[model samples]
Structure formats: structure tokens, C-alpha cells
Target: MTDTHCTLDICTPDLVKARLAEAADTLRRLPSARLTAKLTAWPDVVQSAATAYGYEAAQTRPAAPSPEAISRMDETLGWLFWIENDGRRLLWARALGVPWRKLEDLDGRSHVTLKKQHDRLLGEIAQRLAGLPAAMH
Candidate 1:
């Protein structure tokens, strides 16, 4: 508990960060929500060759997460249920690697204060993970 410690499953600050990051990535890998929204149309004319005069612009959706990854993401997501709405949003945004400047703008809090809050929240989880809670049971 003196330093960061983890063996997967959100056991420490670093582990929490890494798992949250993976959860964020897993979320990004999900299919677009707009899939049901109808696209206006496909190209009027189709080119035989997959090329646009040698200037092809390729856009690929991120690969989908595996069943296992989805489960993990689900568990990771459940951990945030105890947090209040804005805290959850802030944590998720940070997990997605959002810049502190943007977070400051979003939370209307100073960068240092936000970081400290984040660390304290994560530390609470770390404490629970380390199981040093004689104070509780």
C-alpha cells in the first residue's frame, strides 16, 4: 500500500489507470451508435478499381472488442457506479486520455485541483484493493 501495487483487476493506482484506459479503448472499439441512422446514399457511380486517382482516403472503424474484453469493460464500468455523475464523467474522460486543459474547461476547476481529486479518487480504490481497511472490518 506504500507504493503502487497491482496484479490486474484494478488493484492499484497504475493498474486502475491502465484498466480504465483499456476500458476506454474497448469502448472506442464499439460499433458506431449512428449505424441505425440511415446514410443518405451510396456513391452514384462506383469505380471498378478501389482507387480515386491514386489519392484514396481510407477510413476504417476501430476493431471490435472480444467477448472477454467486453466483460472486462463491463466490470471496469461497474466500479464507477459509486461516483457521482460529474466525477464519473471526469474519470472516464481522463481514462480516455483527454488533455488536462480540456478537462479544466469541462469541469470548470483548476488543473491541479482536478488532478488531485482524480488521484484521491483513484487512491480510495487503491486502498480498497489493498485490503488494509481495519477501519471498516
Candidate 2:
């Protein structure tokens, strides 16, 4: 049996928490007018982040939210969550030097995993944005 050792220098849980907190704080300070733009670009930002972190492209096209549905609601939170979760997962995988295939499997097996994280982050960001100036809000 070949003994293979993997050295992982990933950020500690506390560090990750600190980074998330910093991100939330930064988002909170942004003008509300920028919120829509930020939300709209979220998907592409996530895809790029994933690629930057060494996630291989499994599917050329992203999975649609629904097949037969039309006029889907514009859920800004949903968009934010989608971006952050995918990006974070990709980053984590890269930090650990893990195989992209494993990350793809993780993305597939647990649909709600990233969604939950995204929801939490979005809630924080939304709360912050809500406090912005009336014109921007």
C-alpha cells in the first residue's frame, strides 16, 4: 500500500468565521443602489470564483432552477447565496488541495448545504442594506 500524505493549510474555523463577518460588514456598508447590480452579477462571480479555486467544469451549463416555470421571482438573496456558497466551497477545496471531482460530488449530493450558508450571508447583507439611505434603500 502506498502511503500518501496530504498537507492542508486551510484557514481555521475561527478564521473563516472572521472572514465571513468581515464580508458581511463590508456588504452592509454598500449603497442600496449598488445592491441590484451586485445581486445580478452574483452568478457569474460565483462561477469565476469556483474556477479560480480549481473546480473543474462538469457541466457546460448551470442547472436551471426550474424547467417548466416562467416568471420566476427576482430573489436577490437567492442570487447572493448561490454565489457565495459556490465560491466558498471552491475556495475550501482549493485550500485543501482536494480533487475537483470531490467538490463536484459535494455540490450534487447536498443541495441545501450551500443554500443554507448563502441564506445566512444574504440575511446579514440584506439587514445591512436595509439601513442605508432612503434614496438608495
- Indicate which candidate wins on lDDT: 1
Task: Compare the candidates by TM-score and give the number of the best one.
Answer: 1
Cα-lDDT of candidate 1: 0.73
Worst 10 residues of 1 by lDDT: 1-10
lDDT of 2 by residue, 37-120 (tens): 888774554547767786775644333333211111122223234345656555434334455556557677443555455445
TM-score of 2: 0.24
Q: Candidate 2, after superposition: displacement of residue 136 in Å?
A: 2.1
Candidate 2 error regions (>4 Å): 1-109
Tens digit of per-residue lDDT, candidate 1, span 33-134: 576453555644657466755457867888889997788788778767757777788789999999999999977999999999888877766666567443
- TM-score against native, each model: 0.73, 0.24
Clashes per candidate, residues 3 or more apart or on different chains: 0, 0
Q: How accurate locally, in lDDT, is each candidate?
A: 0.73, 0.42
